[model samples]
Target chain A: MSENSTYAEITEAIRAHDSFILLSHIRPDGDAIGSQLALGHALEAMGKTVHYINEDGLPDNLSFMAESQRIQTPPAEPLDVQVCIALDCATKPRLGENALHAASKAKLWINIDHHISNPAYGDLNHIDSTSPATGQILYQLIKSADMPLPDATRDAIYVAVSTDTGSFQYSNTTAATYEMAADLVRRGLDVGTINAQIYDSNPYRKIELLRSLLNTLQLENDGKVAHWELPYSVKEEYNLKPEDSEDQIDLIRGIDGVVAAAFFEELEDGKIRVSLRAKDDTFNACETAQLFGGGGHARAAGIRMAGPISDAREKVLAAISNAIS
Target chain B: MSENSTYAEITEAIRAHDSFILLSHIRPDGDAIGSQLALGHALEAMGKTVHYINEDGLPDNLSFMAESQRIQTPPAEPLDVQVCIALDCATKPRLGENALHAASKAKLWINIDHHISNPAYGDLNHIDSTSPATGQILYQLIKSADMPLPDATRDAIYVAVSTDTGSFQYSNTTAATYEMAADLVRRGLDVGTINAQIYDSNPYRKIELLRSLLNTLQLENDGKVAHWELPYSVKEEYNLKPEDSEDQIDLIRGIDGVVAAAFFEELEDGKIRVSLRAKDDTFNACETAQLFGGGGHARAAGIRMAGPISDAREKVLAAISNAIS
Candidate 1:
């Protein structure tokens, strides 16, 4: 009836719901986990039976999310959730294997997201693309419910908003994001400690993996494209995991001459998982990724190609070259 | 003489000295300028006549040093100073032209530095290699003298100490560094503001220059060595000074496989100045710099080679290869 449902209607639905389940997208990013956990904690504070579940395993870095240890694989039994809430997922399919099926059976599906491409899949969708993250929407929801957020919930929300905005540095950051950050800071959140834990803590093995990757770097297209490949043997030799190599592509992209940087990791299936980063606005790594059936943002993106690392690298470079020209 | 002079003796000498001059090393770094200004402020507090001078012009990034505008070039007039304080010079020659003659003419020469190679060329040398920066030594000197350090002085000292220790991440940092940092933090030094100003703030032109540099990146030796060259025309095109390009070499060195990274800037003097950075403990960039009669720390170093850019690049790569081998 309303252009956008009133806060009162949303509150009424939340109160009427008996059982709530919160879900995030596959390969959950910080915003995904942060929003899921924060909203779940807020609901639990209201004496609601809240279950925070994810189909994909939690990223090791975002393991500090609230009730993170309690997040089990999707229950085998059919869920009877009165309300299903999805955080940070643009499409229903992005809820991955478990939550997608559960959402279909729920009495009412509520989608909370900040993605511009959100499909409004839920019966009650609160999609504010201007918000830095879905966690920002959850903050307002908690306030509307008149529930006091605990420090843990606040920390979860902080991580969600902070990381989504690149610690309040990326182009996505808005004045409202700073207002939210200032409010979070006033609530005695240790921003420095949180930043150090999230962004600065690098293990020795990860540094070694970086060293190994730097050893195989190549420049193409007159040094505009920087590419590197890390073999499975090197990862095994260094005792490094796939997650440990995260952000290595961004580091390469940070080089002064690099407009685009690609890092290829040979998967066990003989496929190569490629990560791409664009340092300039003139190029969009995401568009290149989309060409390979992958999608992401303009500056950062990735795709997986089933082939040898060399073949994958060549294909990605050709795409980038064509795009740039 | 006492095993260690008491606070009273130091205070008496500072109070008694009328004409005080401060000198830092040639190719002065942040620590050198910071130490000189912090000590100058403390000396001025004691009603001493002070003049801060450097031979080479201040690097633009470090132009925020206290009273930096008041710094004078080497004077042709003879100096008859009662007290001459050399802040961060490792050797007398390192003081450059400003204090070359005055250092000999001064009635009392006091050396305050943190360089391990300090020659102790002063009548009273307070060289503590264990300290993080010369500013740390200056902090101790002021505290030992029982002098009240102003907020500005405290801020400058914090900058010096922090920058020299790579924001407390470098190997040179010690337990005392944290203790000093804590003391400064307690004095209401806004670290976030300082860090944002020093590390985060980059001019638009500098960004453009960085973009240009990234366009010329070259990787070799299995990507263990990364190199980029910026001609004088490019710098002029971007309206960038040499100081604006200070961090370019380190950015290249941070590439995944790059054990060594170099940036060759063609100077107006028909010579190419090479800035080098080495990551692993096994490779020392300073050793490579020494091949061209230049010197620096293990991780970062520089050299000036007179030749065409291509020839100089080849020579530098050959020398670095030799050093690593």
Candidate 2:
């Protein structure tokens, strides 16, 4: 029952607690940051002391979703809380093992997530793999407690749901996902404003990266595989940081008739980082990534190997071929 | 009384009719085609003959939603129907003088739309300016008719809704929009498959076009305006046509802090075609385009001007400044 604790039970546990410390996964994504912030806001509204912290702080891409810069990294000492909730994290170590004191100091541990792979490590757990985003799970938890739906919290959750689901363009987007978005809109969510901040704004560096990407676009295996190898020089020449390369695979996967796509970036450490995406999970992206000591979901996966770009490219193509075959 | 016709009344008219000819706008966009197809399918299910026709026929991009290519252009000879439905067309002129034969043959005319500018030319009309799209109005009409919702119809409406609202990225996207999308998903909308077909499948020509656009990216007016020019030679070089540049404005407008964006293309007729997008309606893109003998919505507008690229650029920048000031 505890493993399958309902939102009602999770709400009761939250209400029973006073001071709560919210933790986001390291190098947190919008879902991690948004759900943590939304829950933190909800808890504060319920007259609870909420402290939101993340080890890597926040990335500029997601700073717009944070409130008053409430999320602190290398959090202040003398942390005091009755409940510790891990938001969107699969395991305890995901909360940054080195920063354990902040979470370990709590009296109760609650794990709330939407990942099927998340092990129920907390004393009480509320996890639903059906949810496209953890913010969706937070939407339920906040509702089960019958708290007033604040506009800011609604917007935060909207970011969580939208970013994870590619603004409802991804496969996981469901009837429930759109319904939640409608609810948020009804609650005064500015769909355009939020979307513009999350997606419309792109650094010029992305364009520079795109130029490098398009020049190297290659189709293989009868166009089943569309791929590109980005030399580290592209980043240096474009003045782009590593994170700027995110979502570049989209250009590859979007090719018509393309079933599998790969992006290889030459890292400075003489290692090549490879990202793989499959149109269908049956291709087993995770299994392919595992061959090179990497792991991710079935539709998207990644790995890093110490080698030249050519070797990594040949190896990744082989894994993709094996997976697809 | 006609302009204010309720969904309940509109439903009655559809059931009373035996055959229906659905007319969409010239060069039909997704909203026009989608709403037409959904209503056409609904009428067919109700034991009525449904003729869905467009003067310009379906764009290759939208053929996936055509449902066994039911939508015809320069429709069959001897067209006859009892009811005429104008969908998403702002005016009868949009139906084209050639299409008048099929539509005028009907005894009853029903107009369903969400555009504020619609003339309400139908004997019975259901128009809501507050709704983001015509497919939304169709959703209401179908519900009022109490037709068994089918997957094909739902999918069609979703395509209509998502496309008009730019996949829920535009300001028109409201809570109702998400709710509608959620409902469609529950009814088995394959969001990923549809989105990939509609938005993701970019032709290689688009990349070649982007390369030309990005190479010429320039900023002006204290970075208030970001723009690019596409000389005719680039098209000739890449074997690209005008459609290849459809979403290129995204690359310019997506630049951070760029309030107004422009794309200039050298037209074949010794003129320059300019596309404008304003960050806000206050910028009045339509007003700017109007100066060049063109018009469009407030945020997005286009015009063709008899001038060199430099002159057009200077003149348009001045107009944008005037609008902003």
Candidate 3:
């Protein structure tokens, strides 16, 4: 069976379905939540009942998004739905055990995502690794399927792509991404207010986190590799959530003459979570990460390894240095 | 005479002139230099002779831009040209004395800019304050006037808008901004590489400056106002250039619940330079700046006043607090 599902085929399935439960990954980012809302609201507008569930529920930072409160944690009981759709989750397990149980009653499963590593786990799947964000895929799917474009869908789509692409500054951003933004703005998206909410409103703890991260910054491999570590102590001191450190690695990554930037954090599990970003394909972040049982895209990757923070740092730094040299 | 010049009028003027001189404001930013190159390259592609001049010359960061080397400081002698066009400068004096002398031979002046404060000093002026950046104006002018869009013009336009609009995150960015970016990408723009140069390449000195600034950060007036100071000694200690501190105020300004952010710097001349940003119209930065004989938009403004940096901080912070109250 072919893994890919066309927009028309998905649309037909959607049209046939009377009810739906939508789910995204744990610690949902804008893309994860935005994708669900974008498609969920469109379905709701068409008189289809919809349940928007996530493992972590809505994030405080994303509460400013219009109609964001609709996204809720998995209910105590299962959702009696005809179809279950996973948005932006690369793997089924990422949807979390609670969310999976909540959607267990649905007979049909649909998976739509942009992660390259995503397996076609759903009975019907639309996995487009070429797309920068799943929000974009939903935008196209709804448009092609003649699905109703509600105001929530419009705003959610903008937030989804804008956050994932680093406000269109990342390499994955394409011409289609901008065209979609233009169309959204043309349809009365208040970009100024929305962007301010998405970007400008930051918690004070986030700045403290940056300061702490910068304090630990180091340059290795003749300055080709720049890295910093966050001990578990600092995380407790700053009272930082997972989102507080979001995109903080970009500061080191942006340093001139730096080819690769790595962030090592001591997790509560006594393991180190390492995030790596390469400036170009030459460094191959994924390749370096794979040495430690981690994997990701060429330019960006993630890993988890046993740590007494220093031990993990030594191994990761050496791997990165070897790759750079 | 009416200050506004239509695209047709500018087109006719360009057709009539053979030799031209292009200039932008001193301490030339991306918009300033990018505007000059964009229009200058377009004219050159049309078989018109053009000289691209800036008073202070190019900054180290912008040197990565294609053909950026062409933007040189004024020559010892003025060049004979039919027209002098100033791009992205709010006023004539800001172009610097040397640049004005170099273009003195030109009989006609054309001032095309997006600054709302521009006084329209040119013999022919096309000022659309509604546009977010002068680069956007150039893009539209080139298109409407049927000017050749050379590779330099294409790339220059993107840099100009992207830099000035904070990579299209600023409130001024409109639907047309995204549309223009999409068009440029479609026309063979390598946004990934270009954006990396524009955004990703930051000098280590800039990060040091951030650390220094963060050290002095303070929240006042019940956390509605966030302010910081940069002593001249720190600037000298870091061997910092002015560009090193660019956009650092954004850190404090992004804090949650901060209605305003102020940056106080002790200039080498002993004057205190104050940059103020209001989160919204509730605190009008321009009105506060005007009290110190400075002016700008409601949301962002600047002032240079007598200093002992502390005195300037007290005065500005008081004004901000008063406005918020």
Instruction: Report iRMS values in order.
Output: 11.0, 1.5, 1.3
Cα lDDT of model 1 by residue, A1-325, tens digit:
1134555667788888878988998878788888878878777877888877888767777765556775655776657778898889977877887766755567887878877667788778787877778888888777777776987788889888877765544555554555555566567776556665666555546656665676677778776787888887787788776578876665556555567888899877788888888766768988899899876677677788887888887788899999887
Each model's lDDT comes to: 0.75, 0.81, 0.90
Compute DockQ for each candidate against the true complex.
0.05, 0.65, 0.73
Greater-lDDT candidate between 1 and 2? 2
After the best TM-score superposition of candidate 2, give how far the Cα of residue B2 lies from its true spot, in angstroms.
5.3
With candidate 1 superimposed using the best TM-score fit, by how many Å does residue B88's alpha carbon deviate from the native? Answer: 16
Which prediction has the highest TM-score against the true structure? 3
Indicate the residue-level lDDT of A67 in model 2. Answer: 89
lDDT tens digits, residues B155-195, model 2? 88988988899889999888777887877777777888888
Chain A TM-scores of all predicted models:
0.89, 0.90, 0.96
* Per-residue lDDT of candidate 2, residues A237-309 (tens digit): 8887756787778877877767888999998877898998887654777789889988767777788897789
Per-residue lDDT tens digits of candidate 3, residues A1-325? Answer: 3369999999999999899999999989999989988999999999999999999999888888778899999998898999999999988998999999999999999999998878888999999988889999999999998899999999999999999888898788899999999899889998888888888778988888887887788888777889998999999998989877767888888899999999999998888999999987669998998899887677788888999889988998888878877
- When 1 and 3 are scored with TM-score, the better candidate is 3
Docking class of 2: medium
Candidate whose DockQ is highest: 3
The digit string of per-residue lDDT tens for model 3 on B1-325 reads 4459898998999999899999999999899989988998999999999999999999888898778899999998999999999999999999999999999999999999998889999999999989999999999999998899998899999999999888888888898999999999989998878888988988888888887888788899888999999999999999998877778897788898898999999999999999999887778999999999989999889999999998999888888888788
